[model samples]
Target: MAACAYCGTTILFGGIKDDDLRFCNDECFENGYALVIARSVSDNVVKREANKIYNGACPKCQGIGPVDVHVSHRVYSVLLYSSWSSIPNICCRSCGLKSQASNALFSLFCGWWGFPYGLIMTPIQIVRNIFGMARPPEEFAPSEKLENLVRIDLATQYIEEKSMPPPVNDV
Candidate 1:
């Protein structure tokens, strides 16, 4: 029996892809694929960051000034192999500009897949493109407003309680 390349489990001769297969089953193959893709996405993100720091020039004003960028990946639990499982995006803090790294990445992958623009039409691909675009202040500032509101409310409550009369015992 050959060992599965991913899980290291023994592959039975009659089970799934037979004993000669590298993976024991489709699940193992897909899990391995996800790991590979996720790693690829992370590597791409690192490259992008390095480029932004070392080579990314402003396309609009052509001024390289305080360009803040962040990259992250999301895994689609239900997607199959090559089903838009990993996504990455870039944001420029200087000009508040954001762009989908995944779209370009996906486009490249689709080209490799021999599909014409297949990456853009995928739901996850579309989402990946849209997500990085200039988001609202709240989108990035998760609790800015909430924190201010809580502070105000606490101040108001303190004032009201301080102004109230002491409790009187009922005979």
Candidate 2:
């Protein structure tokens, strides 16, 4: 009933010889170990610059800044209500690539367990994030300095994506 740790193939206690570790063969062990290394690298690279990516000014362009849109679904969690689950990560209004990627990772991996409301809301929110990042590139102005620093050529239109919508003062 035991499965190989690397390939998930059935293995007997006598077949693999790693004591407590369950590897069917040497090849599978090597491959599974390689995957572990790759995942570690991805985690390190993404997490190392997390502060700047989530807090600092836009790395791609000069004008656009991050925002805290009320539409973010992360505001709710199963254990806590209202502001308990609200982790305010930076969101881009002009070009939302990095922010969307980060938020999508969080929603899909970390908060997908948000049931009831999240069951319906989580998918819709991810779609919205995708659309936010899919806006036309021409709508923004590209920055060469950012390209040199981050190696990503992102562009933007405005400093702030959300204006108070002309303040429905008359209404």
Candidate 3:
């Protein structure tokens, strides 16, 4: 099994690129190569819909454009780097609480890698992740209208974005 070049996670189904590097998804590949992220087709659609919602009022503060956007990045174990044991989230910059939560969880399990960076960073991230999850800003908070088609689009975008090497057999 090849390991992901970005996070060092074992790649079970990802393909090899340039005859050497392997990544689970474009996210990892981009991270590995330090390339700009390539947004998939659905990402544009969600951005359009989300813009439509934010176009009106803030979900939390009822303010405007500078509002925060929440995106989830999965964390892999620094020690194991196995797909089976990812921490689910690495950080959410929009909310400080969620940042901490994700970090703390990672530190608890992967804090001993290559010195003490994990120990130093995990606690901070955990607090942020949990706090963000628990008390998102008014603008970031979920709204009743958020549960409709907008949500479906976002979910679809996430699923599609994560599906490395898009499927050829479109149905």
Which candidate leads the pack in lDDT? 3
Candidate ranking (lDDT, best to worst): 3, 2, 1
Q: 124, model 1: CA deviation in Å?
A: 1.1
Higher-lDDT candidate of 2 and 3: 3
- The Cα error of candidate 2 at residue 72, in Å, is 6.7
Using TM-score as the measure, the top candidate is 2
The candidate 2 region of ten consecutive residues with least summed lDDT is 150-159
The local lDDT score (0 to 100) that residue 44 gets in candidate 2 is 28
Whichever of 1 and 3 has more TM-score, that candidate is 3
Task: Itemize residue pairs with steric clashes in candidate 1.
Answer: 68-93
lDDT of 3 by residue, 14-132 (tens): 45574577887877775555321222224444455555654554454454432334432233345533222223221123333344455546555664453344444445554555555
Model 1: per-residue Cα lDDT over 53-138, one tens digit each: 43445443556533333332232222232334432222234343333544535444452332332333454454544564444333
Q: RMSD in angstroms, all models?
A: 19.5, 18.6, 10.8
Angstrom error of the Cα, residue 154, model 2: value is 27
RMSD of 3: 10.8
Error of model 1, residue 88, in angstroms: 5.3
Q: Estimate the TM-score of every prediction.
A: 0.25, 0.32, 0.29
Where is model 2 more than 4 Å wrong at Cα?
1-76, 80-95, 137-171
